[model samples]
Target: MLKDNYGRRFYYLRLSVTDICNFRCNYCLPDGYQCGESIAREKPLSVAEVNTVVRAFASLGTEKVRFTGGEPSLRKDLVQLIETAVNVDGIRRVAITTNGYRLASQIDAWQRAGLDQLNVSVDSLDPQRFRAITGHDKLANVLRGIDRALELGVSTKVNSVLLREHNLAGFEQFLDWVKVTPVSLRFIELMRTGDNRDFFASNHVAGRDIEKWLLHTGWELLPRGRDAGPAKEYTHPDYIGRIGLIMPYSRDFCAGCNRLRMSAQGALHLCLFAEAGIDLRSAIASGDHRDLAALIRSAVCGKSAGHQLDRGFTGATRNLAMLGG
Candidate 1:
């Protein structure tokens, strides 16, 4: 089994298939930037190329894969890529992190392709606020998409990044939305990435604040059960679903770290806050599976205990869009 400096088994891989997205979320990219024009020159990896990279990591004991992008569902061949990864020998679970706007139409196709779960990014329920945050007024579309996914029996989760002045006050309403459906709600702390430092400095919300908010709602947060991501989960009294909190900045889970990432163009990231990455595309293009597998092992070994964002270690300067966070 491959392990990082934390001694936790590093088996999760978050792969980005594209860097271009339809919406310009304030936290994810530069404000008002043109999507297609600002994208990098390199084309996204083909399904076969992504499959090769998945095989290399699976050979070294990687077990779970999460497809992400500026918006992964935006990829025309997303289902093919998901199917390819699922068929890999050691891959046990497959998931995707999306903006939730395209899900109403694509959920059925995605489920048919063997997708295991989903994490939809929904910043605010209010239409005007949502427009301000995402630079689009598609809040109604996203909500309908969520309802459609829940109705179709797909395991869904709502991902709400807690930004201080923006929508932190509406967190309880988000939790209430999750309580009615089978979807799990995850409140993530805002990390310093891209131009986030310039727009909002005090927007970083911690896990403790979430826990306290849950208390006022007469819910009891269950204790930590497994070594999943940084999110600490809680259960509401008599409620069917649960809530999760990811405090990457306030409370670091560095010692229990167990994940790695792959950029859209095919660089493997050992840590989300990493400034540099190892090129897996070059080895794959050479058509040497053995060399590619060796490179993956080396990359895992180089995985940091946790990102420096937690330690006030802010050396990484890459935008979250490029990093596929």
Candidate 2:
């Protein structure tokens, strides 16, 4: 098993498939994605490379792998990528975190390709606010896609970053939606990144406040699964859905970290807020599982205990889009 020096068993892998996002949220890509000559020159990992990488991780006891991106769905071969990961011998779960741009039109194909879990970013329930936050006016389309996934019995989750000035006041709408949606309604705490310092200062909202309110309202905390990502889940008898919080700034947040990130460029990231990554491009391209595992193990041995995000140390990540947070 991929156990770190801190004795944390790594069971999940967050794989970035691309770095081109369509959303320009106030906190993330506010000015829009800057697609330039650099992007044209450098391409993301190919299907064969991803297949080899996933196989290595699966061999090392990684059971769950979540595909992320500047919008993973943006990749035309995303279904092929999903199919590749699902076919790996020991992988038990295949999931994706996307912005839901093509979901309404393509979720059926994804479900057919063996995608079992889907996480869509829905910043706000209010249509206008959603547009303002995401710089796109497609809340209705996304909602339709969510319904389609539910019909197909895909485990779905809706992620909304808590923006103090944008969606905090609309919390009740989210709570009400989850009351009947039968999906995990997750609120992600806004994080400080290299380029989003000013935005983080003005918009960050603590996930703790929502937790307090949840407990007071009869929501019960539930235990986390070994292979689950870092979400503190809560459930209530009256609601079909569950509530989850990803509080990166909370004390000892990294103590429960069980996932490792691998950039689309074939670099291993011990922490999302890591200052640097160990390149594994050659190993991945060579399709040598042993070589890849050895490099991965070496990195895991020296993994930092925590991200220290509270200290204002934003590492190599200029924005969440860079790491698919």
Candidate 3:
């Protein structure tokens, strides 16, 4: 297994196929943000390159691979990429985190290509509030996609970013909606990252308070024994689905960190709050698999003890979109 300096075994890889997104969520992208000249000129790693990186990680005991993007569904070759990752020798699961705008049309193709899981970002069930949060009027489209995913027998989950001023009041309503769905709901605490610092300052909600409310509302907290993600999960006897809280700022789950992040540009990130990363693109381009593996090991071994966000640390300089949130 790939063991970091802190003795954490890294087995999950979150790979970003592209940094280009369709929606401009206020918490993720800055206001008035647009795909500009730099974005146009930027080239993400090729499918072959991504396969090579995945092979290296699998060889080092990586078992799960998740494709992320500004919107992974935007990629024309996503099905092929999923096929490549899932067919890798040691890779057991391949998944994607998408906005779900294009998911309905492509769900069949993705399932046939061996996608094991899907996480859709659905912040609000109310139509107007959904558009207000995502800067798009496709709430119905997203809901359709979610329904299709469930019908297709795909293991699905719904993610919502908790903004104190925007979505806090809708928490109970969100729970009400979840009661009728079969997919789990995860509420993510907004991270204080670049470009959204001011918004985060005003809208960041503590996961602890959310937990208290859930407990008071009769949701049963459940222990996630070996799951690798950051969320603390819960379930209610009366509901068909579960609820989760991911508190990156209000609480630290770094001690159980088990994944590494790879940017679309091929930078290997050891932590979500890491300031910088080691470039594996260059090593891959050199056609030296041994060298590339060594670089990956070096990067993991150099991971910091923990993200110091609680100690007044903001977050990575790159925004969530750039970092493939």
Candidate 4:
């Protein structure tokens, strides 16, 4: 098994399927953004190539896998990739994180392909605000997608990135939105990544702030234990699903971190804000799957006890879209 310095076994792997996305969210792009240029020259690993690496990870005791992207739904062959990973030796859970614009159409096919869970990036309940944040006015489409996933009984989670002025006012509104629906709501503290600092300051809202807010609503919040990917979870006693907080800034869960991330093009990132990555593309393409797997194991073995960025973390503006949330 791949073990980190903190003695946590690295069992979960997040693989980004592609770097292309339909929506250009402000947090993901710079001010006055333009999106015509293609990074196709960067060369993303083929689906089979990805699956081969996954099989190696499975051999090393990985039990869960997550598919992500600039928007994973943008990948047409996503279902095939999902099916392949699910059949890997030790993979028991397979999930996808998408922007939810296309979930309504792909839900049935994806469920049949063995997708175990879904995390949709949805920030605001207000249509206009969502349009401003994501640069897409298709709020109706995403809303329908959430409804469809719930109707099919998929284990769905709605990921809301809480920025200072952006969607802060809608925090309670989001809670109410989940109250009316079956999807669990997660409050993701917006990390200082991309050109995010340009649009807004890094607002470090503690998980207790969320807990305090929920307490005022008289909806008793109880710790429901930790979920995957650094999100400490809680559930309203009267609510059906849970409320989660991903406080990478205010609180670091590096001690309990049990995951590794693979970039869209094939770099193995030991930490989310790492300055460099271990190259696995060349090893995989050389038909040395074991070497590529060893690289992953070694990367995990070197995972820093924790990142120093929590105190004064300011991200480099050039991180690829697929790397961070």
Which candidate leads the pack in lDDT? 2
TM-score of each: 0.91, 0.98, 0.95, 0.90
Which 10-residue window in model 1 sums to the lowest lDDT? 310-319
1-325 per-residue lDDT for model 3 (tens digits): 7998778887789999988788879888746346672455448878888888888888888899999987898889999899989889989889999998898889889999999799999988888888899899888988898899899889888999998877788888887887888988999988877577688789988888889988998988887643346788899989988999898765447888888999888889888778786777888777565678788987787898888877757556557877666
- TM-score (C-alpha, index-matched) for candidate 2: 0.98
lDDT of candidates 1 onward, in order: 0.77, 0.92, 0.84, 0.75
141-224 per-residue lDDT for model 4 (tens digits): 888887887787778998887777778888778776766677778888766654555554655455668767766866554543
- Candidate 3 TM-score, C-alpha based: 0.95
Off by over 4 Å in 2: none
RMSD list, candidates in order: 2.3, 1.0, 1.8, 2.6
Candidate 4 segments whose C-alpha is farther than 4 A from its true place: 30-41, 202-204, 215-227, 314-320
Model with the higher TM-score, candidate 1 or 4 = 1
Error of 1 at 37 (Å): 7.4
TM-score winner between 2 and 4, please give it.
2
Model 1 TM-score relative to the real fold: 0.91
- Report the CA-based lDDT of candidate 3 relative to the real structure: 0.84
Ranking of models by TM-score: 2, 3, 1, 4
